[model samples]
Target: MTHSKRYQHRTIISFFTVLIVFILMAGGVQAGIEPSKVICRVETDRAILPAGDSQNVVLKITLDAPPSPAHIKRPLVNLALVLDQSGSMSGTKIQQAKAAAIEAAIEALTRLGLQDIFSVVVYDTNVHTIVPAQRAGNIQSIINTIQQIRAGGSTALFGGVSQGASEIRKKLESDYVHRIILLSDGLANVGPRMPEDLGRLGAALIKENISVTTVGVGTDYNEDLMTRLAQKSDGNTYFVESGFDLPRIFAAELGDVLNVVAKKVKVTITLSDNVEAINIIGREGRIRENQIEFYMNQLYGDQEKYALVEVNIPKSTSGSRIKIAQVDVTYENPFSRKPEKSTGISYASFSSDSGKVARSTNIEVIREYQLNLNALAQEKAIELSDQGKKKE
Candidate 1:
């Protein structure tokens, strides 16, 4: 069997006549918006699919660019620093976490030229408010509060996150980029201890325009739970093998937050007739009958975020023009402090000519698909290895 038959189950021949229209509608303020700030480009792996047979097509949608320097100014931020003070985090782990919270996380916000808000919460069986949501102007005061955090008792991971979310809610602003940075080293031992509970908490926070980024220091933390929290909130997750790397990870995350140009970023994808919407690869999203909806907490300056949709293309005859997908993005522009929308439409024409389908293949989309395939293979290998070890 040929490679195409082994992978796709059948050979697909098609050509793409994609027409993507990216319209920025901000109530006529679109003219003032820079084109480079945010961009949406879509690509399909192959332009043509096998007629009369459903074939899989990958839709790669990329949102590119960081905010410009001028636009980066005055992008207000509301941040919550949630630290785990569980007994396992005692010693160098907790100390470095505190250093990261102050020297990296807090300092990065101050450099942004915005009077950003900051709150600190520490948990060890009980949640403690080190600092309530307030202006980041009092640098020394924030540092002093962080210095007082001492690791002890069992982990109350969920409680700490809940408290952090509560503080952010108090000062939630549509213009401010709201985020929670959680540092943990152990499993939750008290108050809503399951990963699902934390995932729900993260999801709820996102609805209120807040995202939660998780940093797991040392090897004792539950990666699944931490990662799930970040996924639900559309936030970043970092695994630090050593305590010293915590500060660097925190700095990188804060830098992204400081460079945010848009908040509450959502992408709505509507599939055309005869096309079925599948799951979004590597992202938290919902696929309805024919529509897909997913969101990112914010779009940072100089960053590229993308969504991959595995769509099923129904069989069609040659010379047929099919509407593949329509993408609409809605986001709160930090510069304008108003909601902005961008829409793009993709259409493909069916072609039975093998040469045209082969020539029309997008190299970028093919590369992405191959990369994901490699990742899935690696995951399978790891799973098999673990199973073997269990059997041994």
Candidate 2:
């Protein structure tokens, strides 16, 4: 909901007064190195639950930023720039967007790791691959091609993204963090154009570990479609009211690219025997027979990523402890060039004291749960509006 503090990360203080944090200590991480340990925490909405009938509870699994990456070589980035060269971006909008894109690409290319790859795809009524995915060695040629381009056709937003993702898939290796930065100045006029279309495409792309950051340039662009794609793909989305801020947005996106510390992060929450998970709040999560899972393409340094799962908890005897869930996290640590794993379990005790149950309420988790509920309401409203049932 806010971008002002996008880069300002908060320190993680695991479940305060009313919660418990358990770190999963494993046997095989490189010994002696402090950063080798996974900075993950598992907690519940309360340290204690009521000793009566079934209760629905929230389970939170947090992955604190791993250690600072100053000591290790940064990971490779496989990036694609998808530019909308539609008829609407005729004047300053097109000019400024091109200038900003070229500037950002050149700057990133100058210092990219040997394994990093780059590509550029421009789209109008039809999608075109202006620059195929390749190492950053031909700077002048790339600039020349960008400068000679002109804008005049309708927007094929879907095709543009599809082509961009296809290019990145060329070198989709575990060593590289794949991303597509799409900038647009018009609504989709050709091909699949609805926000739902882009959302479905984004969801599919993320399965391959590729994220598409969408930048809506000027007031004419469709914010709904842009944000839908980004949200579905687990990428950042920006709405720039003016073309003047295109360069700034592009640079900020690059900054995030460099801050990546881990990639292909898979977090699985296995519910205990009796607990039944209702759903994952806030973001997309896969629910299995007895497990809930979430995935992250990459994690930034000191950035906190977490998941909230709503579960149906069975009643337990007063003073008895009942297991809730266990967390298992697996990610590729680019610095160590190896896969890593972390695990932890959470248990809640039953209390007959009404006051004790009330006092054990986790404020933070409750706040997150409220936000998730609000998001769900908004989503329902949008769907209703889309169905032409606004009055209902």
Candidate 3:
């Protein structure tokens, strides 16, 4: 080949090599900051009745996320702590719970800054106030009140919850993160309402923009009821098997509760005419009337927070589709609501092959596990009934 031709060929090869390098760099950048989607699971089970006439169906939804250090801030917290002073919590349980409450209050007072407001509500047959809505400066007094509490009488879990929620309702007007932290060891035995009725009451409180977090201390506690209460109120539920675990759980979560970055964050999806149905499963979605609402359950100090929602798409024959889900977040601004507006939006496209959007596996597992447990419980109940008949 001539020298000029050879030079031209070499130039072409270099051009293609440079193009490949540019493409590889672009791919790496895309991989580094890939968009994430949330997942939610729903599980159900059916059990035969004693007369073999009907079946009961139980449903559960589980929420989860990829493991990461949670971004936390000192929340403007208005907290009402409803402690169980029932007969079962008399000795060590009451002592440890009191110690945990004191530690939580002091930690919030010192670490969460002075903006945090704290309160204490202790209950046995009835709810009593230790410290009403007050600033962190009075945390020492609250701690002293916790120490003075003693366990007695039957458990009035429902009454305590209702009273705590009422106290939180008073603080709802303030631009604060309102919450009630309930610690219990048994089912409701003294309240006029049933557990389910109390759950509905808690759900109503959630509608008023208040959340309730429940902690079940010890194995005898009614875990199912506590879990449902948290779920209904858009709050978190924790199980403490021993006293040793109380301090850390309280310290970590109480800090997060008090210093919330956003309040009343909600997401709504608007589908095109072709789309049929949308289901959101996880800590994210709550169905309210015609629209589904998603709350930002946890917030790191930063302005940005993460949420996941799963959409089910029906197969379409048309090569093109137009469906949009808008994520709208409404957060309380410490300042003026007009100047510092409380809303945000993120868009998801159904056509994108990029795996930025997908279903959540944690939701699926939670649903299946709950369903299986429900089925097992029903079977055991039936077996016991048969055994009693045989003895007769």
Candidate 4:
């Protein structure tokens, strides 16, 4: 072969090599990653604080899914997709939802394999189980069943969720990540329609390690009811303004579900005597005395979960340092298939110079703190509006 031809061949090989590398890396915290790697950190928004009493401070506990190479086993997921087929979801809404459900099923089959389980449940005025809970193997069958879902009748939101939860309980196992993805666009007009009824059900399901994620389509759905159920069960919620967003949202949610690295995660932060934990912002938790406890149902391999504790820092002498937090984290490792725990402690320093305290602020932690505070304020605004006190 000629030298020029050989050089050209080598260049072609290098280009293909680079392309393959880029494609693999683009998956980004997704499935087929080493699942046991979780990095825990406890940090104060500012390592140095002004030397004063009852100063506002933020304590952050972060659980990060560490980056890793591909091809590793993750925990099995048992997902029950509860879809709404009400009269209001007759046009683009129903079609988009069906397509999204089919896409999600295909994605789940590709990632979840034979070890994981999936089912389909649809509801209007009456509840129906389209696909029974079973190991994920027949993607075609699930797709066909989902396509048959037609829009008609009023919405029995409570019955739909209750049925999905029942389906998940069929294969309830200690190691499986049990969850229900509820998609609805209308109000609950049937029996047991109140938000409190669904909230009570969510609370009950969580005791058995089941979470319900509520996706509200358009603005017609009761956001309060949806959010309440999700919050009580330690699940995420989403609001989509248009039907076109359903497919993307379902795919993204399924990706996260398949990439779970840790489950049954428990984080407990005990503050020092001199420090008082006021509340947990952005997420739900129990703040009692000096101890703050929260339960994170699942952690995805490509996401970072954190808790912001609004704290009160007591007066300290200048040039003195104080220990503020003792953080303990426990979770079931999906890769190792075993339980593990880790502990970390955070401290803060007092400075007489305001510039020193400003310089010591961790920008990332502070940004998160401010964002969560804004979210808390928005939540309060919504609550006030709902209570017939919008003028306030």
- Return the candidate ranking by TM-score, descending: 4, 2, 1, 3
Report the Cα lDDT for residue 166, model 2. Answer: 88
**Colliding residue pairs in candidate 1:** 14-48, 66-301, 66-302, 67-301
Error of 2 at 114 (Å): 6.6
For 1-392, candidate 1 gives per-residue lDDT tens digits of 33322221110000000000000000111225443446777778876654556678899888875554552244666778787766666533333333333444334333444256777788888999877877645455455555555556899999999999989988874467888988787888899977799899988988998899998877888887898899888889999875556556655776677677777788999999888986577666889888898788788877778878899888878888788999988887777677888777777777878888888888888887778778668768866866747431
Per-residue lDDT over 139-197 for candidate 3, one digit per residue giving the tens place of the 0 to 100 score: 33444555556556788888788778777767778766777888776667786545577
TM-scores of the candidates are: 0.81, 0.82, 0.62, 0.84
Poorest 10 consecutive residues of model 4 by lDDT?
A: 15-24
What's the candidate order when arranged by decreasing lDDT? 2, 4, 1, 3
Residues 94-137 of candidate 2 have per-residue lDDT tens digits of: 33343444454445445444446777788999999888887755
Error of 4 at 267 (Å): 0.8
lDDT of 4 by residue, 27-84 (tens): 2233553445577889988888888666878888998865423666455677787877
- Cα lDDT for residue 122, model 4? 80
Which portions of model 3 show Cα errors greater than 4 Å?
A: 1-75, 92-110, 138-140, 283-291, 295-321, 334-392
Best by TM-score: 4
Candidate 4 has a TM-score of: 0.84
lDDT against the true structure, per candidate, is 0.70, 0.74, 0.50, 0.73
| Candidate 1: residue 336 Cα off by (Å) | 0.7
